[model samples]
Target chain A: MSQALLTVIGEDRPGIVAAVTQALFTADCSIGDASMMRLGGYFTIMQVIDYPRDLGSVEMALDPAIKRLNLRVHLDPISSVALTADMPNTRVTVYGADHPGIVAGVTGALAAIGFNVIDLESESSGSAERPLYVMVIQGYAPEGVESVRKAVVPLREREGVEIGVHPIEAAVF
Target chain B: MAVLSILTYPDPRLQRKAEPVSVFDDDLHHFIDDLTETMYAGPGGVGIAAPQVDRPQRIVIVDVRPKLGEDCHGLMVLINPELAAWEGMAVGREGCMSVPDFTGNVIRAERIQVQAQDASGRERSYECEGFEARAIQHEMDHLDGFLFLDRLVSRKIDLFRRKQYQK
Candidate 1:
């Protein structure tokens, strides 16, 4: 079996998921892992699919649905790899006044230290006059927790944001 | 006392509702010891329930003191514990030994008053706050066959796979 990664972005509306999944079903592709969410005014979907056919066939199958939904679709062949296990996961949260370089400055610091961002979400709240930006990032840090904290200090100062990095502990019953 | 093996998700036994502990005898004492040993033996474990070890009884052991230091009430052995009063709400990420390999954001009461019987079968009550309250609530859920996954704030965003534990 071959694996493919598909990302669909379009205006927020109902039935987008159903239409996309129906197209994948018609193509005989099975979804492995998927995440769909509404970010501001747009809906975004990221999915990993397993299929017996080639990449072109999967893309062709989704073409009509993509066009009808007025969605932007990006498809690529991906290697079927198992998820990393036993890696330390930390949640890094950054919040402060709305600024243009918050994402880049914060993520750049983490990326420089080889941290892999597994999940991220950000939103701007408050008011137009005094907007606040909040970003929550869940990532795996190979260098451990202290290193991650130390790495973000520069970004914290430069971005003028409150940054907190906490280890995600799972409670054993 | 023995450090019993913790039951993981889909184990069937973890789903079984635990019956209230009525006759607090030698067996009950021994079981509580086992539960305590199991909780301490597990890395970073602050609480545990009898059902996690395949024993369906309303008995749980919580000791956030080791991790929380002077801020906690040391080891808390709650038998047939009940939530008497609760106020406020807060969301905290929780992972369970019985549901290994995953964690989720769970909204629990910020402060709670729990009424329970001690291991000696004496009636007792404790007013706990913060992390202690969260741990107690987490262990208590096991008595009702509820995992942290059931209380997740949002499955779409809050649920996450368990990775390495960082100190």
Candidate 2:
């Protein structure tokens, strides 16, 4: 079996997933992991699938379904890699008035200290005249948590954003 | 005391509702010992429910004293525990041993009153606030076959990867 990354993007509408997934089903491909959501009136899908046959055949099979849904699809054959079960130990949240380089400024500080970002989500809300940007990041810091926290202090001051770094403790119950 | 194996998710047994403790005998005592050992053996383990170990009984052990120090009520062994009253609300992140690989935000009562029996079969009642209250609520949910995933405020936003973050 081979692994393939599939991405689908099109105007938000019903039946987009049904059509795309139905095509994969018909091609005898099994979805391993998938995420589908709508962002700014556009529906997007990112999925990893396992196919018994070659990548070209899978693309050929999905072409008709893509055309019928009026969607853009990208398919790439990717090497399968072993996934680790390590969990993130820290959570960083930054939110404040919208700015030009908040993401770069914050993430750059994190990267400098060898902190790996495991997940991040950012959104701009409120009215256009007074926009608010919020970014939540979950990651691991091998260089010690205090060092990472101190490094981002400058970004917080310059960007005038509220920043908090908390230890992620998941109590077993 | 022995540390029993913890049952992980996708196990049909984890979904089954635990039975109430009708007889508080020596067997029940031993079971609680093993359960306590198992809970402490887990990484950052603070509590354990009987059902998690595949014993369908209404028993749970918790000790937030280690985490909260003198601020906590120490180790508590609640048998047939039930919530009597609760007040306030707070959202906290929780992860379960039975349901590994993910964590989620859960809104629980900030303060709670519970009634239950001790290991000696003596009736007891206690009021717990803050983190202790949250842990009790979480463990009690297991007795009714409810995982933290069921109480998540929102699946799309509340659920998060346990160790890694991916878009």
lDDT of 2 at A172: 55
Worst 10-residue lDDT window, candidate 1 chain A: A80-89
Cα error of candidate 2 at position B52, Å: 2.8
> Which window of 10 residues has the lowest lDDT sum in candidate 1 chain B?
B158-167
Q: How many residue pairs clash in each candidate?
A: 3, 4
Clashes of 2: 4
Report the lDDT tens digits of candidate 1 across residue range A108-153: 9999988988888887888999999988888889898788999998
Clashing pairs in 2: A87-B163, A88-B163, A118-B165, A119-B165
**Could you give me the TM-score of model 1 versus the true structure?**
0.80
Q: Over the stretch A79-148, how does candidate 2's per-residue lDDT look in tens digits?
A: 8887763567777888899989999999999999888898787778879999998888888888666877
Chain B TM-score, candidates in order: 0.90, 0.90
Encode model 2's per-residue lDDT on B77-137: one tens digit a residue.
9999989988877567899998887888787888889899999889999899989999999
The stretch of ten residues in a row with the least summed lDDT in candidate 2 chain A is: A82-91
Q: Each prediction's TM-score against the native?
A: 0.80, 0.81
CAPRI quality of model 1: acceptable
